[model samples]
Each structure stands twice: as C-alpha cells, then as structure tokens.
Target: MFADVSGPSFIFWPVGCGDTTTVVVSDTEVVQIDINDKLMADEEGNEHIPIVDELVAKLPQRDGKPYLSCFILTHPDLDHCRGFADLLERVMIGEIWHTPRIFREYEDEKNLSDDAIAFRKEAHRRAERCIEEGGDPGAGDRVRIIGYSELFEPGERYEGFPTNQFYTRPGNAITVLDGADVSDRLHAFIHAPFKDGLADDRNETSLAMRLIIGSEGNTLRGLFLGDLSYPTLMQIFEQTHAHENNSMLEWNVLLSPHHCSKKAMYEDGLLQQDVMDEFADSQLSPGYIVASSNEFPHANSAGDNPPHRKARNRYEEIVNDAFLCTGEVSTPEQVQPIIVSITANGIELDIKDYKLSESAEATLTAAIAKARGNSAPPAYKVGFGAE
Candidate 1:
C-alpha cells in the first residue's frame, strides 16, 4: 500500500556509503546504480551482509518475472559492482549498462583478494548463464560500453530508445535516467569523470549520476554526486559553462562528492582560498546539500571523517542554512543511517522518524561511530569481477 504518485520519479533508499542507492522509476521498472554491502543472516547463525541482499530487500517484491529492468555500474571498482553477480541470478535483468573496460581473463582477476576473486567469478558465471539461456547477450542482455559522444551527435537525431534498446550510450557526455510513472518514482543524472583521456582502470572513468525527483516546473532540483572527485566535477562545470551559462543548469539538492572528503574540494591536499569560495558558491545553487557518508565530524587521521569543522563552517556561512550529514550532527558519538527521500517539492529526511529493523539500525549506527574516529573508513562493499 503505497500512495499513487505521478510525473515518474522517487529514490527508494538513500543509505550512506555502505549501502546501495536503489532508484525505482515508476513502479514497473527498477534500476540500481551501485550495490554496496548487503545485510542479511548468514550460515552458522551469523549475520552476513552480502551487499546485494540489502538492496533487493528494499525493492518491492516482483510477481514471477524479474522486476529489475537495468543495472548501471559507474565503474569496475569492487565497491561498485560487487553485488551485481548475485543480483543477476536472483532477478531478471533487461539490460546491463557499463563502460568499455572488461577483465581479460580469470587470472587477471586473481590480482584481487580471495574474497574479491569469488565475487568476480560469480559475475562471469552469471554472464555465461545469460548467454546459454538464449537471451541476446550482446545488446539484448549484455551491452557494450557507451560514451557520451555515442549518444550526442551535434545536430543528428539520436533515435533514443526508451526500453527496447535496454542499454544506450551516454547522452551529452552524460547518462540521465528520469523515472517513468509508477508506484516507486526515481530519477538519476550521470555527471562526472569526464573522458579526457583513456586509461586501463575504470575508477578514473566512473560514471557519476545526479538523481532527484520533485521539481518539474524548474523551480527546484535535487542532485547526487556519486564517488566523484573535485577535478572531475570542476571539469563538468567548465564544460557546461562553455556550452551555456552556469545558471542554465543547476541543482537544488546535491550529494557531497567523494563523501565530502577535503581532498575533493582542496588543492595540494589542503583547502585553498579560491577553492573554498567556489565550493561555497556551489552550495548556494541547491536548496539542500545532502552528504552520503558514514564519516561524521572527523574520521581520518587528518582529523574529521567527511568535512572538518572549518569547512562545515564555511558551508554554513555561504549556504546560510548549514550543511546536512547522513548521521546525527548534534553528537559525534551517536550514529545511525539516515534515509533521505526527495522530490521536486522538497526533501524529507529524518533519522529518528523511520525504522527498518533494530539490528540493521544498530549496525549502521556502530559503523558510523567507528568510522568517525578511524583514519580510513571501512572498505566499500561492492565488487565487479573479471569479464
């Protein structure tokens, strides 16, 4: 029993770094950008988090057919694709959109740890299964990597395919998925890691997307910057400015890039005068800036986990309203996962109001507290094995 919503959009769950962002477009289609750690009960009566499990649980149950329409992997990073293999087996995927980079063989994947290797093997096995099942693996089930240039052709019509195409090239050097009308509404826009040069690894080539739903009349816009660094983000801004005024494209909601790491906004590994001013200005563009990080006041040895006190102060000074972190900002000790729901109208995110389960809530809380003091946060829970 969910409310009937129109205009096609809504983010189902916005868990911090550890969890995945399941974007449900309308009620009919489901698209997951990345699958982090999956929380579940494992064998031996132990609680094992299998990255994809947590994500699937959040999704509404599908009848008999696979409910998942697509799986978009930003890059080949383990944290990004770890859960993809398991997900493919459990659900019926219409298409799999990814970059051109793929593993040469199973040995090449051996470079990863033992656990990492297992995940990679599973992904390959499932991919093979899709082939044996007679589901068009090339463009039908498995699609090759696509860049922005592929979709954007100066004056020519792209012949954009809505569903049948399954996977398509990134448009305008970007990939944007606006939800279709249904029970669960979600919209996403891919932004960063602009292809300036080709590289062997895909992390530098991660496909970042900005997701939001609420503003249709151009009054408000929510934005999410996924695991993107400052140089990459600035590159996008520069390119956009070259085409048109910065005001032409702006967001009302923003997900702090790179978990709001100081490195994201700093130069020479230090926050600089000009960079600070630019970031402050960017914060003003959106009505709200949502930080998706377990790191609170200070998690790293450098000091704070996400933003240092000084930087947070700078954000407050410019934005006037103050920045919002995922966990409780009031106390450094108290920690809990905060799920945010956004729309064109406004944002509704409160830690206390919602409850998933006691244990689930406890795990999130403990992780946040532990990450705040540790120099390095826990490793990301996603993985993408050899192709």
Candidate 2:
C-alpha cells in the first residue's frame, strides 16, 4: 500500500504519544524515523494496528527481504526506539542515523528499556564495524553520527570511526542516504542536539531535522524537532538567523515536538513570545501541524503530561483546522496513517482515498450533527462522501 505512491510521500503512523514517520523517498528508497510498535496491540480483542507488521507488508524488498534504506533514531527514549530489536530481526536496514548520546554511559543506563538497550547495542556494533572497515563499510554496516562531541575525537570511544565520510555535524545538510545521492528529491538539514545541549537530559539531546522534499520552488519542508523544549528552540532560531540561514526554519508540515508538550513553546509558567514568533514567521502558507499523541482532553490538570490541551490550543491557533492529532484523525474503527503526497505541483493530504465503513460514516455524521447542536444527522454526508 505504501510503495505504490506515484512520487514521494510522508506517512505518519498513529502510535499514541510517540513518533513513527516513514519517508517514502522513491519507489525503492525509504527512510523511517523513530518507531513505537507495541506488541500488545496485536493481542486478541485489541484493535490497534500492528504497525511494524503493516510496514513490513508494504516496504520494498531487496533480495527477497523487506528493505529499509535508513532508520533514524531521534533519541534513546523508550517510546522512540521501542521496536528497534523487532525491526532489526524482521527487516533489512541499510543504515542508521543517531546522536552521540547513545555512546556515553549513564548511571541510569540500567533503567533503560529493553528496546533502548537493543538499539544501543546495534548502533555500537555498526560504529565499531565502521571503525574496523576504516570508512563506508557498505550498506548494512553504515552509521551516520549526527552531532559532535569529545567522544568522537581521536583516542576517544569512537576513535577510529570515519567522521570525514560518515559524520554530520549540527547545522549541516545531508544529501546522501545509505550510499545513494538523493539530493535531487530529498535532503535533510540537521538542526539540533547542539554541542552545548548534549548534556544528561535525554530530551534536550533529541535529534532535530528539517527534511526538504521535492525541488526548489515546489519543495515541501517538514520539521521533525524531537522533544526539544523552548530554550533549545530559541537557540536554533537565533543561530539560524545569525548565520543568515533562516530558510532552514521554513516548514510546510511540522510534527509538533514532544507530543504537544507545552514545554516546546512555554517556560516559567508563561509562553515564550520569541519562539512562537519564530514559528509564526517561518510557517509556509497552507501549513499543517501534526501531533503524534493521544487525543487531547478538553482541559488539562496541573502536572498532567503531554497531549496537553493548552498546547494543542496554541498549535490550533497556528494551523487552525489543519492541526491534526493522530489519535483523533482516523476512522473510529481503525487508526489510519496520515499520508502527505509530494509531487511536482506541491504537497497534498491523501485522505480522500479512504472509503469510510458504514459505522464510520454514521459516527462522522453524528459527530457533525452534535457539533452543530442538532439532534439529527445532516442531510449531506461529510468526509470523502461515504464512498
């Protein structure tokens, strides 16, 4: 279902309160960023989609095995890397992109989830292989370290790793994926986990990137800022401005950072005006903001974690009706992915192809009627016109 896209597309899976985005770069190249596949979703009586299984069924194959060109881990958070081991066992991943945070040992390392540990083991194995092979190391053994730190210097943990060929420092653009040049269609600009921000805080060390798809005037920009808070975001905007690279902040589609946490735009019990201003200035026309979280409540209580109602309200002001929450956008019966197709003309949401089931159509009609303060369903059907 995914590989059939006529051109490039971005597929955001509905993995509640986490992130799992697949970038279909071409018919043969695919890049997946983060994963939150829950095995419990497959248990009897559960209706949640087994996302990894769904992905395996549609991914293009290489030598009779499902193939993924690149797997990017935004951070070592459990939610972000939950299915790395499973994916590794099931799919043939060509390369991996990760921050240096995974290499450092922390006191809380013992508390890490099994999947996070699995990812670290695999990432370390690839890095070691790159060191042994001197450079490139060919596809499956390739690893692109995004961000700089003392750990990568000579005589350090990654001492022999070939930085010249496999490293990408912050504020740089990467045009190559797994050994192929996809500059004509796709390129990603690394934007975060700045040298100073790579501290003990895992959230602060999240890898942020702006992925540009299509060419020149017809390009669609997507900002995937993983879990960064207001201070780091402000730093990014200021640095981009100082370097006259404000274009790096432009975005047509933005995956709302940190699952719609208020921290992304708020600090000290108040909204940071400068950060919000930068977001407003950089947004392209017809912008779309997606929240990869559970459905937001009407209001949030004190100390309540993300998917915050207040944060959702702020994002709604930015994109209005275009603000979508993964938990609420799909049919009531099943969660469907949010697909945005990129073409020579531009980008368009590809939800029109969905043929709503009878129950789904009824649910939509009833919801619309309720919103309109009516007791009966509207005479006209809404949403893709019920087939």
Candidate 3:
C-alpha cells in the first residue's frame, strides 16, 4: 500500500505505436504525455479513439484549473505528435518539451516529413484560434515550447523546470539522462546517438531512454529504449560505460527496439551471417524483454527481409526465458498497456485485463516474484491464472 505521502504512480496507457503516458506523482503533480487523436462520436454512437481514450476520459476534472504539469512530444513524427494540436485546447500545460526540429531552420528545398508538414499547419491554425479568443498564445508563463537541443549538454544542468531538475547532460553532446536522484527510483536514462549524431537527420536521432522502476534503495529496475537501432544502441553502450560506473547491458526489463524489427538488429540485411551472430550474442538475459509489435508472421511483409525473425532468434540464443510474441503478448492489439507501480516495499505491474497465455503469465509472475519478493500475488494478477 502507498503511504499518504507524495509519491509517483507510473501508468502506461495503450495507444500502441504512440499515445499518452500519464505519471501521477501524488494528488498535486500530474503529467500527461503525447495526447494523440481525440475521441470522436460517429453517427451510430461509435467512438473512434482506442483504449487509451477511455483512460484519459477517467482523469478527474478540477475546477477550471490545469491538472497537467508537463506535456512532452518526443519527436515530430505524426504517430507521436498527432494529437498535440487538439489536446492543447483541453488540458492546462505547464511546460512543453520538444526538439528544435519542430521549429528548425532547415534550408533544404526538399519538403520535410509530410506528417510534420501537416502538424505544422495545424499548429498554426490552433495558435490563431487561441489568439482570436483573447487567450494566452504562449499558454502563460509555464507554457513554453523549448527544444531539447536548446540547453541540453553533458555536465549541464536543466534548471528551466525546477520541479523536474532531475536531468543531466552527461556527455560532450546533447544527450539527456536522469540525475543521480531520478535514476534512484524511476531509472529513466537517455543513452543513445549524441547531439552530433542527431544532426545527421536520421531515425537514429529517435529519443532513446531507459526507465528503471523501483523504490528508493531497492534492487529492481526496468529499462525502456524507444525505437532505437543497432548503431545507436552500440553508441549508447559505449557512452554509458564511459560516463557511468555501471554497464549498459544491466537492465531488468527491456522493450524491444523498432517493434522488434530485424533492421534494428542488422544494418545491411538479415542474410548477413556475421551481423546475425553479433546481434544474437549481444542479447541480455535473465530479465523480461517485451516486443511491442503486431501479431504478424513477419516483421515487414513488404521488405526483402524482416527483423522480427532475427529478434526472435537472438532472444532464443541469449535469453532463452525471454518473452516472445506469442498468445497474448504476440499481438499488439491483444497486448495490454503495462502499468508499473512502485512503493517502498517493491515494484509491480498492472497488466490491464489482457489475455495472457499460461507460459507468458507464468514468466511474468516469476520475474516479478523473483525481483521484488514472495509476497501475495500482485493486484494486477489477482484473477489471472498461470495454467
């Protein structure tokens, strides 16, 4: 049980691909991330949004006050930033964190991403609406859209948002990670392609972070690396080792990169036997690794080869007990939004009423029990059967 004292509640909503992630650190501090498309009612009384909409709808309303403290748009990708325009109309945003790419002065005559192009158009339209209504265009003092590239550098202090001063740029470039204190509980650290690399204008620039969930001074950790590729992952391994005293290979839970795409593991193609072996041996084990992908037989059906197969092969080679896309965890739609709750006692995940195969459930149960303790079953596993 959580004490009445202020603490954080980690809830990951199911928008798969890209959606909102809410973090409630007690009654006063609430943070909502990347609100995608809004809910729309069809003629026959059908709603268009997914399960995450239901969760957002349940957020308690306050008396005409802003309940949200932060809104982070990791990148300008349509899947990631689609709902930001509409969301600004409903929620009170304290700080807007984004990459300078949103307002970058790119001189290339070639058009940027069509998705980003469309989002920019909508952003302008929304800004016009806000101005017409005599509302604050800047969204008040707290509502500033600052780029991550603006002030983030190794050894530099991120002091703009005093509340979240728990960030540091530990390398020579623009990479952000949790300060010593933040890493102590929610161990979310950015380990990846540095600022110099992000300037190359490649998907490798995708924000790479590791989230460790455990109580202060506890032995539990969970790492989430968002859509990172092999080159980037290798760079992270090197940088983290040079910066911190620990190894990057150490993590309790890992979310597979690029939805388990083989390209993430291989540069040229899967047929390259040398690349395959290197990836196969690089796998980390005795921990929970999740692939947030659809239940398709192949990774990319249209591609010459797929990474899904290579990912599975690599897992089999390294972590024999790792979780693969099978039964419930196999299908993205069937995969439940994972909710990680942490307290002084230990850590637990509330797998929303998801359909879990006996083996998958057993693996998860054992992993949790082994990492935390042998107490009663977690609240999320109440009625779930391992058989």
In candidate 1, position 317 carries an lDDT of 57
Local distance difference test values of all predictions, in order: 0.46, 0.78, 0.44
Task: Residues 3-57, candidate 2: write the lDDT tens digits.
Answer: 5466778877776778889988878888999997742222112223356776677
The candidate with the higher lDDT, 1 or 2, is: 2
Candidate 1's TM-score: 0.64
Give the residue spans of candidate 1 off by over 4 A.
1-19, 38-54, 102-107, 113-189, 200-202, 212-215, 218-220, 245-249, 272-286, 297-300, 303-322, 327-337, 342-346, 357-387
**Candidate that would win on TM-score:** 2
Between candidates 1 and 3, name the one with more favorable TM-score: 1
Q: Give candidate 2 misplaced runs (Cα > 4 Å).
A: 39-47, 107-109, 352-387
RMSD of each: 7.8, 9.1, 12.8
Q: Taking the tens digit of each residue's C-alpha lDDT, what string does model 3 give over 284-375?
A: 34355555443436444546322366666665555534554322332333444455455565544455454434443444344444535433
Instruction: Name the better of 1 and 3 by lDDT.
Output: 1
Q: Clashing residue pairs in candidate 2, if any?
A: none
lDDT of 3 at 216: 50
TM-score of 2: 0.87
Write down the lDDT that model 2 would get. 0.78
